[model samples]
Every structure is written in structure tokens, then in C-alpha cells.
Target: MNKPVPPHAPLLEYYEAPAKRSDFVRNLFNRTAESYDGINAAFALGSGPWYRRRALRQAGLAPGARTLDVAIGTGLVAREAAAILGGTRDLVGLDLSEGMLAVARRQLGLTLVQARAEALPFADASFDFVSMGYALRHVADLSALFGEFRRVLRPGGRVLVLEIARPEGRLAHALLRGYMGAVVPALSRLSGRESATLMRYYWDTIEACVPPAEIIARLGEAGLAQVGCATELGMMRAYSARCPG
Candidate 1:
């Protein structure tokens, strides 16, 4: 039999208790870090790296730039950003889970910090790019997170937020939901309990997200310019914007 659903934490207080429901993610990733690439490939159908590449490319990094990957679960996006910047750039992977960072550190050999998205320890204007992959939906205020991203980015730098967007067309929406709610979880369950928990959490969170246009507006309010979005595979999207120079 399946486990009972845990009590829901208030959305506004998500950061206050990051581990209550999310510990599963951290512990799962930590234990399965070695097999993360394989797992993602199976679940994402080899499109995981493609999504990361698309998101990193949108950051438009100049050579030798510094970028921050917030909530960088296993440094997948950070590694791609490093490659996009030609390996001369600084890629900092930050997350609240030490277990996740442990895998990230070993896999990418990049700097990893255990920190929450709401309170990055870096100083103002510390990064040329700030990236978050599938992170915004779980947080409390999208606007607040954008504000933090803006604060850490240098003028002319950008924020790249890659997320599961609300599908555009009716047919596409139904198809994507079927994939996420049905196909993805069924495939993931074979990976075991941790995988099941992650799928459950992520599926629930993605379904609860605001539209891409709303996300663009929030980035604009956070002081980013040229805010834009690119959707792919119908459900996923990469939102990009620049700080005023």
C-alpha cells in the first residue's frame, strides 16, 4: 500500500520548513547522485541536458563570467553553464541540501554552497548570471526570489529561470499533463521510494505554478530588462532577462 499524504505546509512558510516535505529530494539525490544522469535520462527521455543547454544559452554569458545556479540539485545546469562559458567562467552551485551539494561537488568539481534561494550569501552585483532550474514554483513569493536574483547580478547580467510552464494550447496542455501526471511518475516509481517521493512533490508543484507571462512580469518588477521566455516540449520553458547596466 502507498503512504499517507503529509500535512501541507503553508505556501508562505515554505522556506521556514524546507525539509519537511523536501528532505526526500535532498536525501534521494544524495543517495542516488551517482545515478542521477541515468535517472534523468530515463525520465526526461534524454531531453534533460537539452533543457539545461537551452537555459544556459539564454544567459548569454561573456567569457570569464561568473554565474550562480540557485537550487542546483545536482549541478546539471551549472555544468552546462560552465561549458557555455567555455570553462573559463566561475559557476557556483547553491542549494539548501548538503546531500544534493555533496553529489554536485563530486560530479562537477565546482564550488557548492548550501544555502536557500531566499537568502543567497553573495554580495550585491556578485554574479554575471543567476540561474534556477525548476525552482520558482516551490518557493513562497516569486517576486521575492526575483528580487534576490536581481540583487546578486551585475548590471547587464541576466537571470535564467527554467521551469515547467503552463502549456499554451489545449491539446498540448492535455498531452503534457498526461506525461507528467501519468507517464513520468509511473516510470519513476520503479526507481524506488525516494524517486516516488520526488516525482510526487515535483508533479504537485509544477501543476501549481503561475504562467510564464506572469513570471516575466515578476522578473521585470525585480529590475530585469528584456524579460522573455522560450517554451519547449510544450510544458518546459526558459525565462531570461537582463539587469540594467
Candidate 2:
């Protein structure tokens, strides 16, 4: 059985801790889908799309590789991947929110299916690359989700994940917290309720998330090899690992 969202941490537990965590997260994303990319762009200071593009390049994603992007909200990562692929037809996107997938469809015109990460519907050894961007915190069970990644990806397939991390060092950390906890939400007040709520949730999740070391260890446990990580400005994290041949 899939694990329930861990209750050990108050901040990470989630705001809508009702029903299954997956359902609540899905509903939240669906409700926020229309404004999702805009909110991301705001906090990313208009560099969200560019960051995704560069991060995908760093992840070594190449054109013509069969790719599956899990929890690909609004195709943020898929769009970058599509740019490298010359078209979107070769990439498949999976997400739990139809609302988000609808936006993704409009954005990229790629194949998309509504599905959870822990219980992927694809057959084993089906993909050359699998990526999940900015949605690891929303998953109820990291192990199950990564296991699904291992199962679906063909041998030698690579996995990439991009997420914002709590900054290291006292001053940078404090500044980031101020931006996420204060400035972002304050700015969101002008943006809309969806943006504000999403920004708050962003703070909570980033603050209470598992540390980068532990995430790397979990990736190892989930059967990925040669695991490695990179951080930008001590906040943006990029994780890469590969399925063993």
C-alpha cells in the first residue's frame, strides 16, 4: 500500500490535510492551475522558464529520447524538453490534475495522462528518461514514487528533478525565508488568492522538506546509481541519477 503523507513534521504535513494527501494536493493544484505558471514566474523573477531550460540542459536531456515527466504541472519541464526534441510529439507527460494537464496540453500539445507518481500506469522498461520537477514535496511516499521511476525507466535511463531548497548559511537562509515567507505572499496579494496560497504552501514545504543528503540516499535506496546533486545560490536544487544497465 502507498504510504500516507508523513505526519512527523507539522509544516510539511500540508495545509489541506483532509482525505488522502494525494487527493488534497491534486485538488489544490487543479484549483491553482490557471495561475500556476504566472505565480512561478513572479517568484522566479521572470527566470522560471529560463531556469527550467538551463536545468534540463544540465540534466543532460537530449533530443529524441523517450521522456516521461511526472507531475509535470503546466509542462514547465516538458516545454524545455520539447525545445530540445524539436517537437512535443515524442514526449509524454503525466500529472494527477486534469486541470493542470489541460494547461499543459494547451502549452505544448503533447500526450498527457492523469496519474499519480506512486502508481504509474506505464509498463516497466518503457522510457529512456523520467523527470519530476518541483513536485517531489507533494508526493506522499518518496520511496514508492522513485520505485515507480526505477520500474518504468529502461536500463540506463536517467532521472532528473528540480526543486527549490531551503538555503544554506545564516544570512542567505534568512533572506530567502523573508522572501518566501513575507515578500512573495505580500506580492501575491496583488496577484490573487491562488498565488498567495501557493506561495505560502511553497514556504512550508521547502522549510520542512527532507535534506538534500537524505534525498540522495533515498534515491540510492530506490535503486538509482551514480546519484549526484547541484545547487544554485544555495536554494535551487537539481538532482540526477541513472538506472543501472
**Cα-lDDT of candidate 1:** 0.72
User: How many clashing residue pairs appear in each of the predictions shown?
Assistant: 0, 0
Q: Write candidate 1's Cα lDDT for 23-120 as tens digits.
A: 54455456655555555755563347766886677568556788888988777777778778777238888887777777777778677888768778
Q: Estimate the TM-score for candidate 2.
A: 0.92
Top candidate by lDDT: 2
Encode model 2's per-residue lDDT on 1-245: one tens digit a residue.
65543312544355545445667677778888888877776677333768877877777788878999999899888888898778886799999999999999898888899888889999999988888888888877778878899999899998998877787799988988898888988787676876687788878788888888878887898899989998877888889999999
* TM values, all candidates: 0.84, 0.92
Off by over 4 Å in 2: 1-19, 45-47
How does candidate 2 score on lDDT? 0.82
